[model samples]
Target: MSTVAVIGASGLLGRALVRELGTCAGWRIVPTAYRRVQGDTVALDIRDAAAVAAFVERVRPDAIVLAAAERRPDVCQHDPAAARALNVDAVRTVASAARQCGAWVLSISTDYVFDGSAPPYRIDDPPAPLNAYGLSKLDGERALLQSNPFGCVLRLPLLYGPVLDWSESAVTSLVPAVVASQAAGARPAPMDAWATRYPTYTPDVAYVIRAMLEQHAKGQAVCGIAQWSGDEPMTKFDIAVRIARALSIDARLEAQTASADATPRPRDCHLDSSQLDALGIGRRTPFDVAIGEVLSAWPAPTPSS
Candidate 1:
């Protein structure tokens, strides 16, 4: 069986990758976590080049999935240096080490790499990032490609999955606001209606990655840049409405039609996943179904809830 090393195994996507790949019949899993290290998880910081190199040399995985990054646009804008350290520099470090160890690397990127001015972005589309987060990821993509020509860059859009806290993901974060807005004499909560996002489920992404690794195990390596995103497009308002519906609540949400974010965000950077579809590598759980599953985990808030 081929061994796969998962970096950032505690994050949303990393956890899913561990669960899906760990259960696969043809693969062994080596997972690492930084802040939330566990008994079975290996502790390794991806930012330290020597540490990453040493870890890769020790594990010598057949494939490495990089799901670690500072994905917050506001954070990236405030601290471009920090974003560069992880998103760009660390990616180069991993790719360099993976190439040395003859391991295939799959680095996660974002649809924010595009300006979102265009619709259904193709793999070959030119990138025009309007924010620091997107810029750093674009650089990371280049770094990985330059280090290992055979490495793959998997670009994804807004993601939401099982989370320890409602604030953990953009989608779930709106839960509290929707609930709070219905409080007695409470004002309507303003929700962003400008930017459209495809909230992909992490487990589904994990399944797709497994397929990618499986093909590579059969000597059919996927190289260069690729993307996978949920085809359902919804703005923040739309998402909150669905959440409210699932919870059987009359969520008081005021649609904010204009962009008010300090950090520039694309209006609609819809990614075309026909590339993955053609490979027969894809899964998309409807937002309502997936959201219900996620909300079911947490007890409904009090009457104020």
Candidate 2:
């Protein structure tokens, strides 16, 4: 009899969350989409406060998962205002509306909030974002917490899984590029080797969210911020090698130092999920296994004859 609304139901993580949560018994999943509508997902523009407030008021969901955000770091760098509008302002709007409706909010955040100086970050680590995207997300987290004291913030690292588009996720984006390079005999395509990333699977994240929601429904105190990361750390080059090996393609990828790039990024933002582990609410699927599952489900592009 409980209703849960998933905003940004069309994106990579959004879709996975909808799929995972929909399977749970005794829950009504209300999926909202913008720009793209799939199945019964309602179209929504979270940036429009009136529209969001109206939707939340109408749906009156018991819980709202704020999964939509302007996530691309480069995009945020180019237009910080746009990022703030969605990442920060919209979060406040949603949290405020959720508070009014007596609905708990769960906002998705990123590990980018930390600078590369730190290796594995804990829940209480002070955030020093290197990019506008990170700053905006951190702001969103603050807004969500301030607006709804009982709300939760889940910080995630690089994620990959069934994506609406191949280039949507940083992790899966490497697959198409490597595939193209192999077809064209382009050995050693330049990839970032300077920074390390913990690539998590979206399905695993969805599973964690479901578990947390179940606990909350059972009157468990699951509020506050928590981190979830993949089991291992790997550079972009390392990921490309794994992708190539998984697909039986040539592993021709070169390493490009991240520091050489003009844009600043966290060199290492591996998150510590010990808190989530202690709560017994999250699981970390191995990177290789997760990647293989994604590839099995992905409709890979065929090489031109």
Whose TM-score is greatest here? 1
Over 1-305, each residue of candidate 1 has an lDDT whose tens digit, in order, gives: 89899999999999989999878787889899889999689998999999999999998999999999999999999999999999999999999999998999999999999999988999999999999999999999999999999799999999998888887799998988888887888899899999999999988999999999988998998999999999899999999999999999887899999998999999999999998999998999998999999999877565375
Give the C-alpha lDDT of model 1. Answer: 0.93
Error of 1 at 227 (Å): 0.6
lDDT by residue (135-227, candidate 2, tens digit) is 999999999999998799999989899776678899888877787777665665788898988899999999999988887788784788988
Predicted candidate 1, C-alpha RMSD: 1.1
Q: Which candidate number maximizes lDDT?
A: 1
Candidate-wise lDDT, in order: 0.93, 0.88
Candidate 2: which stretches are off by over 4 Å? 184-187, 258-260, 303-305
Candidate 1: residue pairs that collide = none
Quote each prediction's TM-score.
Answer: 0.98, 0.96
RMSD (Cα, Å) for all candidates, in order, is 1.1, 1.5
Off by over 4 Å in 1: 300-305
Q: What clash count goes with each model?
A: 0, 1
